[model samples]
Target chain A: MTLKEIKELLQAEVICGDHHLGTEIILAGGSDLMSDVLAFGKPGLLLLTGLTNLQSVRTADIIEAKAIIYVRGKKPDDQTIKLAAEKNIPLLSTPLMMYEACGLLYQAGIPGVSPANNSNKAND
Target chain B: MTRDDEFRQTFKIKGRDFSHAGGVSTEIKEILQEIGIPTQLIRRVAIASYEAEMNVVMYAQQGKLILSINPETIQIEVEDKGQGIKDIELAMQEGYSTATEEMREMGFGAGMGLPNIKKNSHVFLITSTPGVGTYLKMIFYLDHEKAS
Candidate 1:
């Protein structure tokens, strides 16, 4: 699905990179831990996270995430926004919690980073 | 620049500087991109480099990240002055961590940093002294056939 469709479906607000909404995002992964994201995230992965900090944006850029959606109505500070814009990684926020946001996206056919392998279990 | 030409640069990292923690890694990524490293390989380098930088910011007083590139390989060396790992074997485990709540709040500290670095690099080495510091050397081969 395109990021524009995700914005509409989740009723999210674009915090940065408004011009990037047309980008395609077929896979996503949610985590507040940047370590897990780095370990599991693939190129062009859409990151769903609740951590509203500069690291989130940095992690997205490091892993080559297409975009980020901050859940639970959380938003990052100005520095974070600036970094996101600089990296060309779009940032969005939704009022829904992490669970609901993941469910909605899953229901909409956007799969997690590794749906079949369950690589996250190794971290558990 | 040709593959045979060597490139080397060093970036300093300040501990507890959450505001600018990952900047060096991002800069490293940009440098690799400009040098025309493969996207997949660049991603691996970026991930490993970011995790190493974060380790310095979270645990050390200060550190230096050195990037070296040659015809055959890309190498990163991170050396930090701070409380070093007491048990390297335990720290290498998948889920072992000694991160504080503040570290976790910043979206890291789940103990995957070193392991993730090792996973992404074709050759990895780590050495530390409990009271002194830690040093990590990671190398990625330019020839994709030798990467695994």
Candidate 2:
């Protein structure tokens, strides 16, 4: 689904990259761990997390994630938002907790980053 | 600049600097993207470099990251001064991390750093002493046809 649709469905606030709302996001992965995100996240994936730090933005940029949704009403600091803008990664925040936000997206057809096959491939 | 040309840069990473961890890798990723590296290759480079940088920040006093870009390859050499891994083999194992609680809180120290770096690089090499330091070298081959 497009980022615009996800934002509207979740009632998320656009924190950065307002111009990219129309971009399509293929996969959604929710995690609080940056390592897991780097190990499993695919390019153009949508990242949902509660961690509000500069590293979150850096992780999304490293994995080339299309956008980040900050769950549980979490918001990034100024440096984090600035970095997101610089990297062209769209940021959004929703009042829903991580579990609820992820469920809403998954129920809406957004697939989570599975591990059975993904883990082996990542280690290989 | 075409494939035949080459460029190189060295970036310094200070240890225990959580505030700016992964900054070097981000810069390298941007440089690779600007140079028209394929998305797949750039992702690999970015992941490998970021992992390496984080290692230095978490475990070392400081480190130097050298990025060498040539027509045929992109190579990163990370050398750090700090507590080095005694058992490189054990360190390579997934889920064998010695990261502290603080590190885990930052969403790292899951013992996947070295393995993930190896998985992302075409060539990965690591050497370390118990107390001296660690040295890592990673290379990614560039496909000329894939170059934009």
Alpha-carbon error at B22 in model 1, in Å? 0.9
Q: Which prediction has the highest DockQ against the true structure?
A: 1
Residues A1-124 of candidate 1 have per-residue lDDT tens digits of: 8999999999999999999999988788899999999998887788999998999999999988899999999999999999899889999999999999999988887777674756333223
- Could you give candidate 2's per-residue lDDT for residues B7-54 as a string of tens digits? 879999999999899999989988998989889899999999999999
**CA displacement after TM-score superposition, residue A15 of candidate 1 (Å):** 1.3
Give TM-scores for every candidate, taking all chains together and pairing residue i with residue i.
0.94, 0.90
| Candidate 2 docking class | medium
Candidate 1 C-alpha lDDT tens digits along B48-110: 999999999999999999999998999999999999999999999988999999999998889
Off by over 4 Å in 2: A115-124, B1-6, B143-148
True contacts kept of 2: 0.66
Model 1 residue pairs with clashes: none
Among all windows of 10 consecutive residues in model 1 chain A, the one with the lowest summed lDDT is A115-124
